[model samples]
Target: MASDDLFLTPLNALHLELGARMVPFAGYSMPVQYAGLMAEHQHTRTAASLFDVSHMGQLRLSGPDAAAAFESLMPVDVQGLGVNKQRYGLLLNEAGGILDDLMFVNTGEDLFVIVNGACKVNDLAHMQATIGTRCTITPMPDHALLALQGPQAVEVLKRLAPGVESLVFMTGGNFAWGEVPLFVTRSGYTGEDGFEISLHKDQAEAFARALLAEPEVKPAGLGARNSLRLEAGLCLYGNDLDQTTTPVEAAINWAMQKVRRTGGERAGGFPGADFVLAQLDGRLPTERLRVGLIAKERVPVREPAELQNMDGQKVGQVTSGLLSPTLNQPIAMGYVRPEYSIEGTELFAIVRGKPVPMTVTKMPFVPTRYYRG
Candidate 1:
């Protein structure tokens, strides 16, 4: 049942027409599944899948000091990002806590940023309140975001819009789908070879239907999106990360570029730089580190489940977990004390008051299939 207060994406009507099971997520009525969770999950692994991500916030920052000003807010190399190149970033507060994880692209003329749906309002306010005087902050709520992800995504997209196949990971370019304009980037949250296409909200359903016409493309929903991301070991904002977690503690150290680190040419200017950089450089002590876990048995250990050692003392808690559709094994990611963060360390997940034996493992239980070429 669609609620009156929940916002609807551009494709909301089409989703209902396709018999999608809708659910409220991030204050929007989103499709949980169309065909089914397992079916959509496996289809995305083997073929291309279309996801409606219009609920995410898209905004632009443009000015003479855009890159430099944006860099001062996030702990990433924003000024160093080449034109048309995209980079992952963490928005931090003064206390070194993550406000949100975002993806921003340097499009030569302006910075195009995509933030999580739930935190979009706050993210915009924070950016505007902090750097609005230095740059022009414009929100693009009229743009609809869609992700076409899988190994065959290139083949499906290139047939509709030529030259998309030439794009590599973390890069974007402007293209046209018939008369409609598209801004596409070779990236995705599913850890697959894919593209995130941005277009006008009015043309979204038409474009989506065009993609669906392809034999290789099927519409997936939030259910499979969550499972796919979990299997890929990607962090979910409110689940695996929040205001209480730092980048180092979340184990996403790669998002912080070298230039933002302690001894680089342009360093320690972003929020909480002293603390975050100290942790990154190993000068500051970290209490817990994020780790991957694999269950010994078939039981699925889910989020908020307490982790315990052999002595029955709680050492951690599961943040994300599911029975991986690709690997056919239960896998999870959680924060654990430093000593228990190493691979091959045995731990127990207290599910339903019974300990489920598990072993600390490496992430990407299913290897990422990014198209770097």
Candidate 2:
């Protein structure tokens, strides 16, 4: 893609001023790093980092049938979600494959949605096509989304927006940063106590500047964001998940509540619910499963690397991998044959035709520090 074809966010100028290295991501010119990837990654873990996620899409759904109609598109308890509560959801196809992963909040009178940057267009179209007649779908293209993440995020944000401190994980409410109208969710891609703030584009620069003015908050980019989420064992839509992968195969079946399962009150109404539910109940077989791998040797195994067993026969392939900045070791997530999904099972990653020893292990390579209370 040409540089001229790239889209800019509300914080584009601010990011340039802060010495961020901008890169093309999902049709937008986004900051990939500031200071450096490693430094930014560590800063977010220890303190707070502000990320410009405005490139992602935001939408509002209203009307009497909004919740029920929206619930029919994904396997989750959207109708039962309490006011100001949020949940992670998956967009599935007829074959039980993931279309895109998203987050939705039942904010009193309306449903607020946030979808991946790369898939926002398709996601919007899909929703409109399926539920247009049942509800009001309003796209918020003029909004800016920001994520303030880490252990000290609450401390930093609450000082500016009161009542934010009272929020627990997966809950959110309307708040303000001085005169700016803000809708904040106590959730984030990183496995940390954080908040994702949605505000109008006009005030994004001023608000982002205000947040950066805080001593606890620093500007971070997409590079650091990816590393942080990976450490938390979160899935990146295009990388670890895609149209060909199902929630059950991705090991994220937990997001599908019992209400959408085989025998619940509102069971099997969403797309691909039948196969997904069967897989959930052990009636359907999965060819492979997503698992976390820790490299025994120091070599870093990256995506597209083939996985092999003791006999050197290929069993699966690596989807995402890197040298974990926190652990100071190499960690990766990948899909493997069902029989090879056991924790502690030894495997090898083909890096440059050489076998690098690795072991399957539980995820969240670095333990998550979510604030539930």
User: Candidate 2, which segments miss by more than 4 Å at Cα?
Assistant: 1-3
| Per-model RMSD to reference | 1.3, 1.3
Please provide, for model 2 over 1-373, each residue's C-alpha lDDT reduced to its tens digit, 9 standing for 90 to 100: 2359998898898999999999999999999998999999999999999999998999999999999999999998899999999999899999889999999999999999999999999999999999999999999999999999999999999998988999999999999988888999999987888999999999999999889999999999998888888888999999999999999999997898877886756999889878888887889999999999999889989998999999999999999999899988888999999999999999999999999999999998999888899
Model 1 stretches astray by more than 4 angstroms: 1-3
Give TM per candidate. 0.98, 0.98
C-alpha lDDT of all candidate models, in order? 0.93, 0.93
Tens digits of per-residue lDDT, candidate 1, 1-373, equal: 2368999999999999999999999999999999998999999989999999999999999999998999999889998899999999899999789999999999999999999999999999999999999999999999999999998999999999999999999999899999899999999999889999999999999999999999999999999999999888899999999999989999999998877785766877888888888888789988999999999999999999999999999999999998888878888999999999999999999999999999999888889999886
Candidate maximizing lDDT? 1
Return the TM-score for candidate 1, rounded to 2 decimals. 0.98
